[model samples]
Target: MAKVLVLYYSAFGHIETLANAVAEGARGAGAEVDVKRVPEPPRPAHHAQAGQSAPVAEIGDLASYDAIIVGTGTRFGRMSGPMASFLDQGGGLWAKGALNGKVGAAFTSTGTQHGGQETTLFSIITNLLHFGMVIVGLDYGFQGQMTTSEIVGGAPYGATTIAGGDGSRQPSAIELDGARYQGRRVAEVAQKLHG
Candidate 1:
């Protein structure tokens, strides 16, 4: 079975919810999966809200996994500081091209419809490229991308969800479905390439 890692940084609980959906998809695809989060300094205000707690990732080597999916909350059209800091520490793996040929995908949460979801996903993709990993993304086949009646987040670039400016809105069922598709697609690819 392919081994997949789902790593993410969530300020509130939305991204964490999305991450779990992704993990479920990956597991359903028959891949061994590990869901983890990057460490960040405690923010009491953010912590006041209930969120899923994941073990801080101990990524000693990226080569150990056949696929990796990263998610984060956007910070002004970019990845959150904690996620950026976590990726920055992967220089050792990068130097060795340890992640080369592995499947990589990204997801993110933003505060508004235009709140840099694509930019944040692309930023994570850029880092994955630096590691020489093969990139994966949601395809047009996913019906969630065609929704025009309700506010939802899913695009060809990656999966996403709008958290609202006040961080009140949660991911909708359609958004979670898109996230599941992304995870299943990545896992299937990883299985083909590495299993």
Candidate 2:
């Protein structure tokens, strides 16, 4: 079976919700999936990471996955600090090309409709590219992203959702579906590559 990891850092639970949808899609596609969250900072014990039920991920373990799907809340149109720091720690894997030929994808949540969702996805995609991983995204097949009838969040870069400015909004149903499609796409790519 293709081993897929869904790694995320969610504040306000938006990304966490989407992460589960992604994992569900991957599992449905017959991939063995593990979902993990990034470690929190040492001093701030009250942050979202502390209350998360998912186990914290080990940087070294990332290399073993055939595919990795990353999700984070956008910080100024980029990935959150914890996620950026976590990926930055994978220098050893980059040096050895351990992730080369592996599948990589990204997802994110934003506080507003125009809040840098695509940019954040690209920021994550850039890191994956540096590790020589193949990129899979929320392709056009998802269709929900193209709908203008509702306020949906998704892009060719990856899946995404809009959280209201005060973080009151949860991911819409279409957004979750987009996440699932992206996850399934990544798993399918990994299966083709590894099988």
What is the per-residue lDDT of model 2 for residues 1-195, given as tens digits with 9 covering 90 to 100? 899999999877999999999999999999999999998765532345347788999999899999999999999989989899999999999999999999999999999999999999999999999999999999999999999999999999999999998888999999999999999999999999996
lDDT tens digits by residue: candidate 1, 1-195: 999999988878888999999999999999999999887646533643344678778767456999999999898899988888889989999998899999999999999999999999999999999999999999987888798999999879889999998889999999999999999999999999997
- Flag regions of model 2 displaced more than 4 Å: 43-50
Residue pairs of candidate 2 with colliding backbone atoms? none
**For residue 51, what is the lDDT in candidate 2?**
71
Give Cα-based local distance difference scores for all models: 0.89, 0.93
lDDT of 2 at 117: 97
Cα RMSD of predicted structure 1: 1.5
The regions of model 1 sitting more than 4 angstroms off are 42-51
- The TM-score of candidate 1 is 0.95
Worst 10 residues of 1 by lDDT: 43-52
